[model samples]
Target: MTAAERRASGSLAIIFAARMLGLFLVLPVFALEAARYPGGNDAALVGMAMGIYGLTQGILQIPYGLASDRYGRKRVIALGLLVFAAGSFVAAAAPSVWWLVAGRSLQGAGAVSAAVTALLADQTRDVVRTKAMALVGASIGLMFAVSLVAAPMLVEVIGLHGLFTITGLLALGCIAVVFWWTPPAPVQHANVPRGRLADVLAHGPLLRLDVGVFVLHAVQLAMWMAVPALLVQAGLDKDRHWQVYLPTVVASFVAMGAVFALERRGYLRAVFLAAIGIVLLAQLGFLLAARAPSLPVLTALLFFFFCGFNVLEATQPSLVSRLAPPAARGAALGVYNTLQSLGFFAGGAVGGWLAKNVGSAGLFGAAALMMLVWLLAAWHMRAPQTPKTAEEVLADEAEAG
Candidate 1:
């Protein structure tokens, strides 16, 4: 990659990581901590507080990316970051669970993920785009691992309010990085076609990928609705939950490496289907183990869950970037992310409801059904083409120019 490509990819990856860290950091502690707030003890309201970000994020993701395509990437991103920072501050000072929910909704309203991703695509050549996206993906995975381990420790020192304060500060820092270090957006030709939401919605393969992401994240949020409480019930202290998470996350990374190797060897479709199958099985495992609730069994189940989750998380966006029409990449990704956020909202709301009414076992069972549907959809989906060589990408660019 060129120096410009490296700078753009590396800087944007960190920015994305920073944003995700803020979100994931709260997940581990929110259920227990929020109970201290007014109206926090209501399971439904707590779930809404946790997942409300997804509602606004889902509503705005496509509009933000579409705006970026027309207006400029950095402008949209910077504005979004400012909004995010404001939301963080709001949450930090919130006196009630309802206020926290409103704050979380505002955080989602920023909706810059599609814009940042579109900017990465804008800055890199086709040949290097996948690798750049992979770097971003790996950073996200790393942040998630770090958040699981660090959140408990950090909460011990700063409390949840302090964590929100830190996240707000990080957003301000990301805004500075955008202005100072990020690359300029590429200029578009007057005659080049811009992507339409309607077109993206109509595309079959893209729709499939969107559904896959939706199911993946929904199941994830649903599982979290129960997993932390399960750990505590199994005799692990909330502070020491990291012992299980840290090891499982590390093992999942190793598993991801193996999956990536298989994809490189032309087993993309096979591996994709297998990964979805594993996710389904893991959910089933949770359902069964929910009855007995043993630490060893839950820990084993978590390892399998993360193994599938990590691979899917890394694979989905790269696939979207590759399969999207060159002109409509931003819109395509926007739709993709919109569905993902919707999944988050659905997972938390529905999962929390299920946990409260039907129990955690029912929640896992529902998640398993969702994955079973995804597995079938994935089975019919086509594998992405082999990535172009740098020389080939350059030749194509030369011809287009």
Candidate 2:
């Protein structure tokens, strides 16, 4: 990789990490801590408060990414960060669950993942793009671990409000990094054909992966609605839940080494489907945990969940990037993130509604059902062929001629 590529990847990784740390911090505690507010007693409302961010994010990701093409990546990103920071502060000051929902909605409105990813893709070559994306992924994985440790402890210090304050500050810091540190993007992104969104939307493999991401994230947020309480029932205090999370998350990362090993052995499709199956298994485990709520049982289930979650998180975006045309990469990813965000929204809102009416049994059962559908669809997915740049395609055409 070139020096500029290194700088871009590193800078973007840090930016993503900082923003995600804020989100991850809330996840470990929000289901439990949200009850402290006035409207928080309503499980459905609490779910809304937790998941509204995804709704706003899903609504605007495509528009935001397209805007960056006409506008500028850094400028749009900075503006987005400011909006996120505002949302964070708003959440920090939220008086009730309703206000918290509004704040989370505003936070989602700052959908910058598409722009950030497009910016990184612009600066890096296809050959190394996976590694760059993986850097971003690893940073996020690290943040998830850090938040698991920090949130339970910190929530005790300043509560969710303080975490939101820190979240806002992190966004402010990211804005500075974007403007000053990120490498200048290549002009090729603009020179290339501004491909139609239909081309991306109509893509078959891309659509399959999109559905998979949606289900994956939906189940992710949905499960949290009950997991924290189950942990409490298993005799761990809310604050000490990290004892389970840190080890499970860490161990899960190690287990994912086998996933990569399987991929290297030419079983990409098999491994991909298996990962979904693993997630499904974990969900069923959660369903049983809803009955018994044993600490050791819950701990093992979490390990399986993290293992599946991490593998999916790393694979899907990279696959989308590989499958889409370079010129239309932004649009493809926008569509991907949109579904992902909506899954988050559905998970939170629907999960909350389900939990309120049917309890954790119904919630996990629904999640497992979604995964089953995704696994079936994913079964037909073809392994992605490594894509060439515009230059490579043109050169090949000329050579053939």
Candidate 3:
């Protein structure tokens, strides 16, 4: 990467990290905390409070990205961050479960993920764009891991209200970074035509990626709905749950490194398939562990589950960007991200229902079933064509004309 590319990637990472930290910081702590409020004792209601952000984000992400095209990236992003901060304050002060849901939904309305991604695409030339995105992806993954560890401690120290205040401050911090860290936005690409809904929907490869993202996040949220409780039931203290998490996260890194090595050796498709297979195996492991009710057994199984989840979480967006056209990249990502958000909403609701009605075993069984479906869908998916560098593709197009 050139100096400019490095700067662009770093600036984007800072912005992405700040915005995402606010959202993810609450994930590990919310369900248990919200249960203390009125109506929060109901599992489904708590799930709603926890997952409502996905619903609103799913609805507005595309519109937000498209609006950025006309109104400019920084302006759209700044507005979204302001709204997100407002929602954070609402959530911090919410007294009832319904009010928490409302606040979460308001937070989702900020929905600038697609817009931010589009701006990143605009800033970097194609050859280095994937590397740039990898930085962003890694930032998000790191934030999720950090949240898993930090949220509980932070909650204990300052309470959930303080967490929300911190999130609001973080949003304002992103606004400052936008101006101080990033170069001025580029002139819009003349050849990159406006995104069309019909065309974006018709793109089969991108649709497959969309499904992959939806299933991925759905499974993620659903697992958390029950996994933490399962850990506590297994005699692991809530605070010490990190013991299981830390090791599993470390193992996932090792596993992902091996897969990347395979990809570099020209076996990308095999590695992708293998990752899905591992996820299926992990789901089955979760189901079996739930049935046995052994603490040691469940802990072992969770380590397996995270290895698969972490790998998939890191890889899916690269697939989406590879499949989508340059002109429609924003729209394609918008649709893909929306599906992911919906998964969170649906997963929380369904996971809670299954756990409440049928118990933890049933919840794991349902997640396993979803993974099974995703595996089937993936089996039929054609591997994406490797994308040409920006310079190469542009040269070819000019010569053809």
Best by TM-score: 1
Alpha-carbon runs more than 4 Å astray in model 3 = 125-128, 190-192, 387-401
**Global Cα lDDT for candidate 3:** 0.77
* TM-score, per-candidate, Cα-based: 0.94, 0.93, 0.91
Model 3 per-residue lDDT tens digits across residues 1-401: 77877887788788888778887788777888888888988998888887888899899888876677666788988898888889988988988989889888988888888778777777776545556776786677677677778888999998777788888889888888877887777877666676665677998777877887788788788888888887887788787776777666666656566755554455657766677777777777877777655677876676666677666665576666666676666777678778888888888878778778998778877777877887888786666555566677899999999
Tens-digit lDDT track for model 1 on 1-401?
89999999999999999999898899989888898999988888888888888889999999987887777889999999999989999999999999999889999888999999989988987656656887887788788888999999998898888889888888999998898999777888878868666778888999999999999999999888999989988999999999999899888877676755676677878877888998999999999988878899999999998888877876778788788887788898898899999999988888889988999999999999999999888788987777767677899999999
Worst-scoring 10-residue span by lDDT in model 2: 187-196
lDDT of each: 0.87, 0.87, 0.77
Q: Order the candidates by TM-score, highest first — what do you get? A: 1, 2, 3
| Clash statistics: count for each candidate | 0, 0, 0
Q: Which ten residues in a row have the lowest lDDT in candidate 1?
A: 255-264
Q: Which stretches of candidate 1 lie over 4 Å from their true place?
A: 391-401
Model 2: CA > 4 A from native: 189-191, 258-265, 387-401
